[model samples]
Target chain A: MSAHAHSEDDHGSEGHDFAHPMSVQTLLAVFFALTFLTVITVAQASFDFGAFEVATVMFIATIKAVLVMAFFMHMIADKPFNAIIFIGSFVFVGLFVIFTLGDSMMTSGSFEPVVEELAPAVAEPMEVKVDGAP
Target chain B: MSTIEASPEVGHDDHGHDHDHDHPAFLAHHFDTPEQQFDSGKLGIWLFLVTEVLFFSGMFCAYAIFRALRPEVFEGCSQFLNTKLGAINTGVLLFSSLTMAWAVRCSQLEQHKGLVGTLAATLSCAMIFLGVKSIEYSHKWGMGLLPAGLFAYDPSNPHPTDHPNYLMYICIPFAIALAGVLLWLVVSAGLGNKMHVAMAMPLTVVCLCFFVGVGLGMVLESGDETAEHIDVHADPNGLASAPVMLEAEKAAAAEAAPAIAASGAMVSVDESVLEILAGDASNTGVTSGLNALEQQNAAAGTSTITGDEAVVGAITTTEIDVMTPTTAGVFFSIYYCMTGIHAIHILAGIGVLVWLLVRAVRLDFNRQYFGPVDYVGLYWHLVDLIWIYLFPLLYLIR
Candidate 1:
């Protein structure tokens, strides 16, 4: 029965109706790779990478995500249109993060005035209350 | 959703409506062939997955914005998160992804038994992840590490005396579900129904996995706490000394200062003496206040001093703890938001996986009708993919 199913799979592969059955070996390999990357990311956290810490961690994570997308998710065998739209979502996410992050960075200076004006107002009352309490 | 519910009756009803096309029972009336139906469903699921990606992107955006803005807060709060549990959960979700993908493959190859096993394994992993997560959440809540409005974490005495036993509350639902599954197993065995027995057996194991997760979480959390305790006591010059001094100051504030101050012995206090005193003071409670003062004098190994001068000295030399609510609470808010929504997705994934499991048990899937399993597999993988990012972002923060 298994041999017959394999033959059918082969025959169907010539047409467009075949199911993409990923080999067990490939699945295990991807799992091991992901696990290894997880360990590496954890170990990397113990080190002080200075300014590149976030970038380094995110880089390893992106690699793991791509491995998951390509192999476990079978994006390699999936229709190009599906993969395209899925990856396109990330493009939009990038734009969203960049725009919002950039805007916040650009306007962060504007917060200084409010914070400075409120600091004395908040501090003076707290000091007065503390002195008056005793 | 209706398409995913392609039970035999639904398939037969569709067949009765379209006798001309002679398609498989699983194929809908609108599709020309099983392949067309499969492709259409696949496309639809991918589109849904894209929306899921974008939906979670908003939280990631919030995380990035906040982390970039207050890197220090992220640094401080991330320390409270147990890295070991995060790594374990990452491995669990990744393994579940493997099982899910294998289930999809098994369905494609018409391996019903293997499909059932893989689906069960995937569900169990999800349960374990939630179990560990509940431990993480409750432990934080016990420490008063809540969101901005509710944050009351005291650095000096993190484990408050009155915190609720959150683990017991978390275990109640799992315990009930386990009992229910066990009852089903017994009744099915007594009735001598082989099918019900088989289903009940795996359901029983899956239910037990939740407790296994809870047990695992409790053991690891306690182990972490013990390690932290030893770490504090092992180092005299460690930052642990500061919290000890703060504890002493707190003890003195409880009305023991003036009476001891009237004795008027001004002995200088060192870090080690203060640490020893604070350690005893914190453990002995308010009633042990005088005893702790006597121990402080002995531990000082010098001329005895009154408690008032010691308390004043400790207060004047207090170290600043930056892990206050206003600073660290915002990080926890994002932490809870991102991981909370992700856990909800895992829960939703479990619901759908159970649906797939039922269908798989009925042998409703074949080479051409395996779209449901495949779609759910895709969703499960996307959930894991999000965790792949979340593990590092939240746990592996530098």
Candidate 2:
């Protein structure tokens, strides 16, 4: 629970300060996965995804982003609270995006048909009175 | 209490030694341990990546809306963009990401020589990526691909009436590619071993940032011009069928109705009231004249209001007028904004990378302490991912 607990890794007398966190194999595997994802993204773009085009591209990109975050970023091995912080930021941004989309959809254009239909039913007597006066 | 455990002689310096002095090589002061330090760095990068995704979502949203509104126009614009260049840039970025990952591994394993070499390799690939992007950008520029009024100076080269050349779409693609390359270089070489590469890293980063700033500044300003043009078109001059006389009549009616309606109880007015009423009728006469002129123009088929013809074509000519002695289009506006923002982010990424590189070079990192390098690499990769989508959306959507 102490902040100084993580500082234990900084106490070498040799003056060397850098520490390697990942193995060569892990690096190689991540490299291949990233490349594979890139290929897949480009390949997928060529097809007619129509309304799903951006969504599909973004979905694949999200996978690639996750891979980079997990392995290359060392997120997979990090503290649970760190992961929580990362996910929390994502959740906040996600909520912002979803709320914006929902609001935009809901407020789009006007539903004036109901008003139009009810106007005649409610105002017919008034219209007759006005016309008769004229 | 346990005799099985080995007991050491504690009569000497052991009595005065600090337990805290036995810390490992990788931990920073703020973290609980090397693991936690690494964890926090990784967390920071992930959070940063989320912001990036959100930032890029704006462009994707623009692309989606425009595509929905004018799929045919977008598709037509896409046909002019080069897919091959996009694919190549995608390949280059993917490779650079690989070398960046390798550089982190080399640092982790205490392979200083290998780390330096891999960092150099990653840097080289990044430069190559930039070089390729430059070539693509130059081609777009040379071919009048830049946005309207942003140095697209080929007046003699008028676009054919039937098919306007929307080469500016390629601008965003090349800019994204360029930003990707710069971001990679920053991660691998910019932040490797700081002490040895200190001067090199910062200087390279500053220079790259300057270039990116200038390039993107041009892009943003170019977009501003297009927006200005759109605003101009949206103003009074925008609609070709604005009824001047009818507007005058409506103004007069609005003024008179308030006064006359207020005096409804006193219907029997003097000659002054009659004169006022006659003046209002005369204004309506002017409106009728305007209507007659509109009808005459319609009968002659000289008016620009052809119902069957596409509105985009007429808007294109108006855009040309706005961009005349320049270029114009919403596509141009989007192109400049997307590429411009991406470039700025790349410059920032490069600054971090170079700083890490300087540290790596000075033996500041070891087998037990390279979390910064790995996290920097993660940030760099996310920058590249944005370009992957941007390139096709701008250039190869066809």
Candidate 3:
């Protein structure tokens, strides 16, 4: 297709079929949805859900990311290749988190004694570390 | 097409590859079609975003490790963070992302005016985020809520033993100022005339020496003074029972919290206990150490000292010593690492957006070709996406 096949922009283009890709209405709607979800994130923070806190907050954030990618960023309408490239990053990030968490939980109790070791260092008098033993 | 070709100032990139004059000027000579060019750029940006995610994932890993290892400290530290400000920053970035998205759409539809306006708005919002961040940082620094190494001055920590030696009251500000100057000197040397590097090099050494010399003097002098009082109590092997003595003092002071609150009217402090609060002000040049505590207490009003005569007792006579290390510092280290790296991306986004804005004014992007705007929009959105996770992790974690 010619690059300027339907490039009658800003004026005299009303009758052209699907001349503009995205509508102002959709952008505004996505904007409002994003703002609403932000409010939800803040509100949910005040409550105690025990084990659900991290999962719930992260889930909400994922929804927010999806909205951003799908509508506002127009990733929904992008070519499958571009969409894959974007979504692929998140997939890898997810895997990274999963692997790290899995490994850490496998040896969880090993870190329990770390607190006792760290707490005493503060009570000791300040000695400049780099200037010593030379 | 003829009009577009005549405007080749829209950043023409061609390495011995030439496009026909009919092609839009922004198109590279190497690409057969504008669609192909846009596709290539978009793919490159997506890959860059991938690297960004991987880059930030390291910090996230650090955050996860620490949060898992020490949830209680993380919770205690989170309480110090102002949620309202974090929420405000989140709102600002969200709105900026909206504007950024709108800008991309504006470029695609050939609304040059809207494009410029949205880009400007996005830049302003980025600036606003940074401004709020700097304010939060300064407040933390002033209160001594620093990361591990700089943990010297928190007047707000409640327990005086949590604060580092009082000598840092002078050292922190002086050292920070000198370090700032040294940074400025280094930046100037790098950016300015190359001929002056010889002089600048020596000056850098002088600044370094002055910093080390003054810091060493203060530490040694203060170390001597601390030895006279608390040194005998500290075991040279570091396993010594000085902490036991500290524990006893903390308990006694904790009990006196109420007595000090009532002291203005009906209470009087024993001279020995008074020494803890006042820190021997008669020692020349040492103003009352209680000033930070008093100010904090006055602000906190925890003692309900309703009258000027009501003196909150010196609950802590911890005359300046290095505080015991707390895992809370790890939380801040991750905080700075994550947010600091993110802020750098925001600054970079602003730079790219500004470039696009200037080009937009030049009528570089329109319905036929808005690849740069689209590319930057994607990058900015990724920055926003990172913040979406960062907000909950660093600030809103329950």
Candidate 4:
């Protein structure tokens, strides 16, 4: 399919239509959606959702990011290859965060006691002994 | 692959000409068609954007790790961020993205005037973002809400009395640039050079937007401060109660006043000194130490009080809150790292947008060659995308 597209590009005339100019309405709609989502996120911060707070905030942000990537960035009209690789990068990011966070959470119980035991010693001021002063 | 091999042969046939009349000047010699060239550039920018995403993900990972490890710290430090300013900046950036997307559309449609106007508006918004950011940073710096090893935020007195006015220092360079552009505008108008005049006019407005940002920031920040003050005054257990403590300390200090006068020491007691004394009166050891120092100064015939001592004395006497370097400071470290790098990207976007501005002024872009505009637009929107996440993460923590 890409080869067929390339062959057309080889024989295509000058000023061939590839530009996909977004309508002003779409742009304004995206902007308003983003603004509205921003307000929702800010408003949500005032309420406590316990363990779901970060997840909820991130979900709203992801929606805003997708809107930006799709319309403002023209990803909706963009080549499939570009969109695939760009979206694919997030998979790796998810992997990286999940693995490290899981490890940290698993070991956190052991780490807490060590920190508590060492904290008092760390907090105390050190006594300096001067040579030959006594 | 076959088309790629055929393009160079075609280019080789017309290699000696001063201009390739067959192809537009914006079309590169390596690419056979503008569509192909635009496709290649588009792919290249998307890949670059991919790398940018990965690079930023590392910081996001750090944020997730730290917040998971210490959610309470993020909760404590997030209050220091002004949500109103964050919302305003979010709106500014969203509007800039709108202008940027519109600029791309204008370039594609060959609307040169609209193109230039949108680009200039985008640039002005970028400057305003930086301007507001400088206010946020300087305000934090003045309060000593810095990263680890530099955090000195005192919750009792969030605003330190002696911190330098960081906003003035931040604005000095923009002020000079504004002056330079205004002078250029005047000179160009005087010389009747329409092009230079046209250039300088937009440049001057862009520079003025920085100061406008600063003024906007100052107005909002002062309003927040005033609201806080009113809240404190209304609360019976808040800092408003300090004055009652002040009166008691004054009575105690009055008892010690006659002893110093009998010693022939001409000590001048000022309000700030009295406030410091009052603030430290709960600590009897520090109060006695201060009194002894005053008596020693009297015996030495040196009655002058240094401002540094007063500030230091005030800090030591105040109780340190949980928002110190070891606790909430790490959140600020991550905050500065993420947002600081994002601001640098905005600065970079401004540079490239200026380049696009000059090109647009030359009427360089059309339907076939708006790749640069589109590419820069993508980059600009990415910066906005990062801020979308940053605002909620840094400022909107529950």
Candidate 5:
């Protein structure tokens, strides 16, 4: 689909538009909420969460992404198809990570490179003995 | 306004209006109605945004896999990043998204003044974001905290002024100057009492000039860094690229006078981006800071400085410790890739918005024909959405 859409009136004033725009107040509210969430995420990162760090940050990020897709991007008031596409795209992203990352973890050890020559030579310092020259 | 609804206005000309003209100048021939056109356009933008999501997802996957494989390295490298700057950038992008949305709403409402105002505001925010990013990049460059092969980070080693990132310094001034020009033009156009075409049109043209100028300038400035970018999977010699050597030259020339640190130039990669680097890791690189720390800590009180003091106070060994990062090269590689792509998108969005601003000043958009503004708004929001995720993942990974 093309990025630009052709309408009856470019600005669509010809017919009273059926679509509804969020009120300025609502838009501002969403803006503030996003900022608040950003603060929360940054603050949370400083504290050690051990294994939960990834999960917690990911969860917060998901919430922020949702708010953006919904209110700021108008997915909430937009066509269902558009919302589905956006959500489906993420689902696919999740799948991509799962297969690649999951498989790599499953068989991580003992997968050494066949060519020993390929390994970059680890530099070792010379041992200087200060006794009478050998 | 808070409880407003999308109910079609009574005056909508869905039925053939009295005007004999079949289509408005803005309407495309194929679209049956305005509603269809609007929905189709929105859907297309959503789809485009979806593609963008998938684009960044690949990078995210790479980062995740590497982090999973080398969790300790990732953690140690994460410390080298300045979280404060990341937070600032997050706020900048979010604010810009808000302004972009406001511009779309203004176009829809036929508020020409607000449309121009919001567009100008969004452009400024983007410039600010880029400026801050450039500063961060320069800081990294100066400290020699680079991606692999070129990774010379030694935070514990004292040598703050070792390698100044000339590229970043050059780009920052260019960005600031152009941003200032754009601001002055927008304000002049807006503040004029009369909407005189002669007066306002030039402002739009000038806005485009600086926007294009800054964009081009940024691309050229980063050209050096981009040229050095290698596919690390190839892992060739772990050779530091030419740009690293060039920067190192300037650094060496600057610091060569301090003969006190000559004894410290014992390691191969110790000097900031330039002087002591002779290509081979063993030729001139500083010994590992971990080793120095052990030796100094072991021999404390014998000299004027201790291990920690020597690391921070002066460059006595070939190994300079700046941003004591371990395995930071891969982490930074991912960091630059993700943020760099996002920054490119912002540049593209800026280009679109600049065009919209020109038309907006032309009074082309009424309530009926603001599709371009709306579409661009969606794109900008998606850019912000990605950053929302990036901030915590890259900066706050703990």
Candidate 6:
């Protein structure tokens, strides 16, 4: 479908007016929701979650971000193609993070001591022994 | 407030695009359909947020690595931080989010005054937030308790002054000064009624003085140490490690001087040492007087000092011991980098909040057009979230 054809406002053969795209109520709802989520995530940080602490916090943050995108941003009513584009972006980020972290974690002990070759006999060096009378 | 405005009806010439053709007043004309426009906006927001996540990820990575390597150091450092301030700031930011939402609501309702009011409220909250944060940061600054790299402490080391963080010594004072000025401006402007102004002036002066005193004292002390550690040793063989060895020897001398003085040996005691020892002796003497009989019995029971008690005394005198520089070095590095980066992000986020405030005051956003407000609000929340972790990780870990 053409981009314009998906517009709900133009499809008024039944004479139904296009509803307000983003109402104040929805915005307020989202605002409170996001604020609450932030608070919860912060509160959760005080507990000793050990290994799950960072992960749990991040999971909640992702949920909050998604909510902001969907409701306050009107993503649900938007064309499906936009979602595809966003998912594509995520794929790239995922690949980048995974590969980089993977490398760091896996090859940690592979760092060999880097040895530099002596300057190609630029000058003769004199060595002195510990005991004096050379 | 700029006069430049884009007509929402442009670039639709191919279909004889006219305003009469079901043109939704809210829809901008770049998209082929409203759905496309909405999707594009959402997609753009996601990408932006992703970049933000990645940007913040760098700080988190630093935090994770340091926390893993020196958990005790992080815990010890965190114990000094005030989590209450962090929690209060979190609440303040959350309140600002509410105001931002209300402002957007006003925009949708076409209530310009309400929009302005809500935005003003949000701005006030942001200002309040920054104010509280300043107080917290300055408290740390004044105490000479900044992270290891900046105001390093080696309570276990005798000559902590000798191992002063030259870099933090140089940088943190200016940052504190700048933050102080900005904070003063915000308070004077945001909360500056006649009454608030009356209350603020003295507070500002006092805070400014406190800030300056701490900064000057730290820099002066650090400068003295740096000067003393200056290497002038002439090595005939030009050994590479000569300066390092020289510095080490100097540190050792600084360390040994105290013990020698304590034992009434050959070392000369500085006024500071005499003062500290005098204080400790008096304090301990008072405590011993309270339990004289027990102390006499203990002294009679064991002629030699107990290992644990000696160790406790040693630990108490760590700031005087220059022996274990490793612990100080390890912990200091972690503390400075984590807290320093966190503070910078807080400053940047505050800047963004200020910009958003200006836009809100201009009545640039309404209920139907509050995307920017929402976006910035999300960013603010993320900043707050990071601090929540940082507070515990740095200040209250133990």
lDDT for predicted candidate 5 compared with the true structure: 0.60
What is the DockQ score, from 0 to 1, of model 6?
0.07
Give fnat (model 4).
0.53
Best by TM-score: 4
Provide the lDDT at A44 for model 3. 86
Off by over 4 Å in 3: A1-20, A108-134, B1-22, B153-324
RMSD of each: 11.2, 19.0, 14.6, 12.4, 12.9, 14.8
The model with the greatest lDDT is 4
| Best-fitting candidate, scored by DockQ | 1
What are the clash counts of all predictions, listed in order? 0, 38, 7, 0, 35, 17
The local lDDT score (0 to 100) that residue B279 gets in candidate 2 is: 24
lDDT of 6 by residue, B1-398 (tens): 11222434453443333433433444475544434344356456666756665665555554554444334434434433454455555566556655665554465465766765565566556555545544444434443444322443322222223333443453465457556755765676786554434333333443343344334433433232222222111123434554454355344443534333233222122223332232212222212222222232344543221111122221222223211223333344445555566556655655665555555555566443555655555455455545545544444333
Candidate closer to the true structure by lDDT (higher is better), 3 or 5: 5
**Which regions in candidate 4 have their CA more than 4 angstroms from the true location?**
A1-12, A108-134, B1-21, B227-321
Per-residue lDDT for B182-218 in model 5, tens only?
A: 6665776677734444334444443444345334434
lDDT of 3 by residue, B104-138 (tens): 88887888878877887777677657655654554
> Ten consecutive residues with minimal summed lDDT in candidate 3 chain A?
A125-134
Interface RMSD (Cα, Å) for model 6: 12.6
TM-score, prediction 1:
0.75
lDDT of 1 by residue, A1-134 (tens): 11222335444422434688999999999999999999999888767787898899999999999999999989998778789999999999999888887877766621111112222212211110101001
In model 3, state the lDDT of residue B255: 49
Worst 10 residues of 1 chain B by lDDT: B313-322
The residue ranges of model 1 lying beyond 4 angstroms of the native Cα positions read: A1-17, A109-134, B1-21, B227-321
lDDT of 4 at A76: 90
Candidate 4 lDDT tens digits, A29-125: 9999999999899888767687798899999999999999999999998878889989999999899878877876775531111122123213322
